[model samples]
Target: MTLIDALIQYGLFMAKTLTLVLAIGLLLIVVLRARPGGSGDDDDDGSRLEVVDLNGRYANMADTIKAATLPPKMVKKAFKAERKAEKARAKAEAADKRRLFVIDFHGDLMASEVGALREVISALLIAATPEDEVLLRLDNAGGAVHEHGLAASQLLRLRSAGIPLTIAVDKVAASGGYLMACVANRLLAAPFAVVGSIGVLAEMPNFHRLLQEKGVDFELHTAGEHKRTLTLFGENTDEGRAKLREQLEETHAQFKAFIAAYRPTLDLSKVATGEYWHGEQALSLGLVDAVQTSDDYLLAARAEADLYKVRYRARKRLLQRLLGADGARALARPLARPIGSVARWLRNLGGARCA
Candidate 1:
């Protein structure tokens, strides 16, 4: 080949090689970003614990509005004077002032956030003193017994450690939610918030008759007689129905006992009837200590104590972040199909054991 032609060919080869290299580098970057703890510096458990100074945020909001309303010339002088006053107060009371840590729990049917709650509690158990107070802004309408039971036990850890626990329910804290609330030293709720569904219930549909009409047979084998009580496909006898009721009663008794242990003064018999009430009525029923929103309580508490909002956020896996939680689960359904039936059965069974 001529020198000019050879040079051109070499240049083309170099360009292709550079393009391939760039593509591989970009792929590497994407994969690294998708890894656990890749988005930021997270804990060994692929989580991040954040504590925000709510007092500073509240002060900033007030200062911003105050500055906007004041004349430009006076704005500087007013802020300066406020800063001086704040510095003097901090110096005088910093040593004696107690801290109030706040956290939030927005519950669902599974009480799925309990894992993050455990991490937050673990951190507080080490950092918080008896003088420090904890406020849980809880909004849960209740869920599975075992899941909420675990969540409530995490709160009990604070009480056990001598740290005062206060629960503020601005919306709803019914059934399993109440199970956790009753454990608090003080429970506050919004005026119209729903509360108190201190009861247990289990229900499922039986399709044995439908299968029999279609000339289809479904068989289930269990080692124990009560192991398969209230089957979905198999025929259910009066004995099986009675056994399920007996089990539900047993769970209900345990639930009532748990509340009584934490809140000795509550009249469980009056409230534990599978019914819910609004916040004002809940207070009358002795289910909540006071009818007040979380915001008001935090605002009032900010004046006396330094308030901080603590949160534990688990890093989402790559698929979760890419497709969202539900979509990721859907994508994995085929791989999990082997145990899908059993998982659904257990999930339905758990639905019956709500607080």
Candidate 2:
């Protein structure tokens, strides 16, 4: 085919894709409008822990362990004693078994999974026993400071409850991701997983010179001196730059403290130098405790306990479901005044009806 024909075909395909996406989006909006807040579960009891037995699927595997696969050779002499102790055996077996609860947190720039993590931890706290353990599968390249900080605190909830928490980093856990990983009692990572980027970063595009050339005035008012430091359109001064650096340093210090509180063996001064190490390197530097995939850990623990993958699937707001995260936020500011506007309109309509 000629170059022009190929280009035309590609353009047609993209247009078709866009059209399909728009159709789906509109269909979703119609569905949401038909049933708003009708999914039920407006109470705390709505969120529940879902448990799955891991051994059921892989029971025949070579590595599988069964406590009583072979029965003791029963003779007529011992048959009477065994019959009498049958109920006692059942009670003893029930007391010996423990549970393993699993959760997954895939973080982005905003660390949105923290909300669900909080709910999952709260639910588990009520149902989990002291012998039971929690495993978190974490995957992120790190993002915002406060966002990941809060996400880390959610993991700390498991620790505060004295529940054994293990973090599995299959791909990457750097910066804010590492912050949350450190809160776990044990950290597992893939052999080549990127881990341990303990640092701070701030980047902003400055259009001050362009504004100057265009003779545009951008005035920023603030209550504090360092409140309006580095900005997009404003001319940055040395004092503002220094203050920004100071704030970054302070945040970094807090990050270090958080890591230290959990994993006291690590020397943060060395590994927290703003560079990420791979899983094996991280183990040598005391960043991660072991090199293992999430699958490997789960499969190995299957024989010991009843493993359950827990999740808190929160119902999204009507607007959010229709427009998604970014589009919802983009339209949120304008929609904030709707309640007052509707109330005022109803009052005026009532007055007119009375007249």
Candidate 3:
């Protein structure tokens, strides 16, 4: 070995060692200083209502007033006075004007988006009046039953409060998503938007056959006969299968009853066939009220009234921002459980599927 080569190797080794030591020190400091999740001054105030101004109504109002003709200085004075008076009148009118608040829901199978939904609705219930409207832009394929039921219940709060709630679906609202949408006083969907699939489903794989073939026996014990209707590892019997079907049917009935109660005029027999339809087809079938895109509705509403978006905007933690997503998730994975609770709550709740 050459002397120069050995010296170079030693320097490189020392540099690498120092770099790793510094990294470990930084991580330790971050861990020590880290705050618990959703525990910040901003967390409490994270959610807020923002005014959406797609049109320049507020900005162009001053230039829109008609000024009276007069001599040079008098004309300027009259124009200024007119503008001032107009501003006061506009302000007064706005105070009395009916408001329309907006909230958005982009969901998945687990209906994970319900947590934020509840937060946003709580704020709306405080500010919205009978005359004021709440628009929810929803998109979801659907998921778990009880989870989605809770989500639908959250939207029902607005209905009970006498706030006119409308749901706009640009893409899809099937199964549990429809459960949440059906609570709306009126549903507006884009022409190509997917809707319906009023149904219930559930399924789980069994490894009983694999175990039996391997000469391994599986035994499951439950206090109640129906406590465990199906098993993942144990053998599934016809009785267990029948009991599972019964439970799914009952849940489906509950879903149908809830929807029918809210939308009494709908023909449950024809519409609840577990079949999906495009918005255009759905309108005639009583699945949706109007075939209109959210873009058009919001654009029109913007020109007519003040459009405000109500939301709970949470801020990222200091460590999260500093270390980035991977680091935060890695560190948080163990300390924070129910880790994906909000993510699941954020997903659109869709109806169950059986296989």
Candidate 4:
């Protein structure tokens, strides 16, 4: 062949080789992604070690892949075997008739977390029988009022379904957190878990003075007189401050009333003073029924009933998973905000809706 033709042929061969290598790499990624349960070993001793390496942002792709890779027939057989074993085990442990469902709430109250909590509550409702007891392992300092209220309302589903609900607070269940715990038939808390704060607050900084000092004029308009209160740039008024205070007081009263309604045993006269207490103190104050951590309760209950730690599988759509992983701020813009402000608003909205 001519030197020019030979060079072109070599270049084509190299390109083909690169393409093949790229194809193989893509195939491997696909295979890894497909095996969702993660890499693990099933030993001859009937023990399996499943490795779930989740990046903690998206749905656990590793678990999905593993579950997907298993054949439907085999999965069915395995499920049947597990059920049979469970039945036999339950019979053997007849003395322990109480089944325990542990519902854990450990993070900030966000929309995604709320969604997951809702799913968990729903699953627990379905799985729990009349005799089975539902235990919520709650640990939240506080968060957006509405979000936490919704979370608490999800717990109420257990009550509506006639399943007994017990809230076990280990760290804290203040403000909206308490809103959820109040619904439980029994409220248990660890020694130092912060337990109460029955009030509402809203704040905004006014740059009106700064702007005026710099010889800058600010103007704002609203369709409704009360649409925007305590503005950032607008002038303040005695009437406006009074109105805001009145609104807050009304919300606080409603919060107090809600607690009273759910936990009639509590002394609203004392506990509604916008103060928090430790777990033992809270029990005396009637904020909690007993002092117990979820771990202790779970360990004790494992002897008799089947222990299931229930949480919803966070099933994110493909786009969200990709965007969340890409550090795409714009994708999360709708969900992002000052954490405190969001929590306050969530609580306020939730209270208003419930009221």
Candidate 5:
């Protein structure tokens, strides 16, 4: 072969080697950029929970970007601006159409965290116009008497304002839960969601037998005969038992009468039997009006008027904030505190078993 030909072949070999190396480097870079579970990346948007301002402030669709899921620190930021924009947009759009406010009530029915609920309801009552509707997404299995009763009273606030209230139950709304549902002008439920247990129950244990075996006598003193009918430590007389039973019967009667007043059309004799029915069966029994889920209801009504979900932001307790201090000390000794917590939990378990 000629020397010039050999030189040309050497040049071609070098060019091929350089191109292969560059291609491999580009592949590695692409793989590194596609890593999973990134913070604030485009790929992570769908998996992240969004903090939506239902009140109407950030109307610009682009402004509602994938913000970081709300941490305690971020939640402290005022959502007032976003809420204002949303409200303006809603008001403008609702000028020609009817609107509805859909609210949810789930989990244990108690007045412990009721302050937040009252605030949300008060806001809705003030913002709602005469043409707007109020829909409650109620799902409660019932709890303490006075607490549930107060929760039910909050629903009446909307009614008293002359706003139409509709209740949609996706799951169980029994006992005190039904007390709230019955207040709505119309009630809808899913096919299998438990409904109606219009009754009250109270149960307590009497340790009289155990105390007698241990030779421990307990004394009782009361001003009235009914004040201390069923005692936990003292023997219960027939008169005391009779009195307790009478009290329960009276409460049950009052519950039935209350339901009758709200729903005069319901057959009081059959529904007051303390039995629950599913959605279709409940419709036949007059417990609910129709079968529908909250999602379908919202989607169907979206084109008619602006839809807003009402919920109260839960405040963190002082103790939790104190323990979760934001400082170098917290980061330095995080494991120490976590280990101590586990140890205390184990100690409590052992003590409970021994007792």
Candidate 6:
């Protein structure tokens, strides 16, 4: 073969090999991402709960900045004055000093952070006293009913222990997120945070029409009449749609009831309309107790209480440590598109006849 033709052949071979490798790699990444405790907990080898002194951290930050701008004499004077004040405050409050335990739950659509939250809550249940309080820095836009429901139930454990649970939302606590937030004894939200989407949603795309046009046969079998409703592959009927709607309505009612049980003073009729409101509006509607960000709350608490941020950390595998979950997803998208294109090209090339 001519050099040009040989080069083309070699390029095609490399392309095929690369496509196969990427396809396998993408599959492995998906499996790893889906595995439970991908964030470090499920692994048997390396996991621990991390407790950080927020009070000390805040002081250090202030001191560092003060030292940067102030002259050496003023810096020393400031440090000495702060030390005197700290000793006096520590002496007076030594007998009744309260602890504020902070936990962060940055949830995804699956409420996967629930695992780490579980560890934190368990630790608090053992160590926290009735005088102490929990401030959950929660940021979630809502997600699966069952997942967020479990997360809510976990928060309820603290309330059951009379530990005074408080949840602070800086960005959003809607739908399933609201479900978890309502479990708190006091819920705080930032002025622009989204809150209160007390509604149920169920939806799926049906491909029966496309299959019919392509002369493809699809069959579904179920023993019970309501076993499957509003499916993805099969044709949907009015009866199935109606049943799904009924289920959604039932879930919405339960959600409202759950919120009412926690915040008995809320007017469910006005706020449970499947619409979210900003934090200020939520405060007016009684969806949140106050319009304050978590940072503000923590800063204020730092004056009278010792603040500690608790977290669960697990040792990560080499691959997990390198790419992490988000990185793996970012890598997967580029890999998946090229794999599909290469697959189609290979199929088309194979179909072409030679003379």
Q: What's the TM-score of every candidate structure? A: 0.82, 0.70, 0.73, 0.66, 0.65, 0.83
What digit string (tens of lDDT, one per residue) describes model 6 on residues 1-355? 9999999999999999988987787777666556455563364656789999999999999999999999999999999999999999999998999999999998766688898888889989999999999999988887677788889999999999999999999998888889999999999999999998788775445789999999998999999999877667788899988887787777788888898999999999998888899988999999999999999999999999999999998656445667986785576666666765666444332121100
Candidate 4 whole-model C-alpha lDDT, 0 to 1? 0.70
- Name the candidate that leads on TM-score: 6
| Residues 248-323, model 2: lDDT tens digits | 7888888889889999999988988888899889999999999999999999887557778887776656767779
lDDT per residue for candidate 4 within 1-355, as digits (tens), equals 9999999999999999978866765564464344235453322322222222112212244335645888988767766775697679768777756676666677564423676677666666666777898877877766556677678778878898989888889998887778878999989999988899766766666778899899998887889888755666778888788888887788778777878888987888888776789988998989999898877876666555666566555433334456674553564343334544666564444122211
Residues 1-355, candidate 3: write the lDDT tens digits: 7999999999999999978866765675576456567353445543454555534443454334522334667657766786697678668777666778878898875666788788888888887789899999999887777778888899999989999999999999998889889999989999999999899887555678998899998888899889877787787789988888888888888889999998898999998878899988999999899999987887777644667777775555566678887997787665344535644433422224411
lDDT of the structure predicted as candidate 2? 0.77
Q: List the residue pairs that clash in candidate 1.
A: none
Of candidates 5 and 2, the better by TM-score: 2
Scanning candidate 2 in windows of ten residues, the lowest lDDT window is 346-355
lDDT of 1 by residue, 1-355 (tens): 9999999999999999978866765564475366554555454746789999999999999988988898988989988998999999999989999999999999987788999899999999999999999999999988788899999999999999999999999988989999999999999999899888889988787889999999999998989878877888889889988988888899999999999998889888899898999988998988889998989999999878999999998877776778899996786564445455566556766256565
Displacement of residue 157 (Cα, Å) in model 5 is: 1.3
Model 6, global lDDT = 0.84
Superposition error at 137 for model 5 (Å): 1.2
Candidate 1, superposed: residue stretches over 4 Å from native: 1-45, 320-346
Off by over 4 Å in 6: 1-23, 26-44, 321-355
Scanning candidate 3 in windows of ten residues, the lowest lDDT window is 346-355
Q: Which stretches in model 5 have alpha-carbon errors above 4 Å?
A: 1-94, 109-113, 322-355
By how many angstroms RMSD does model 3 differ from the true structure?
A: 9.0
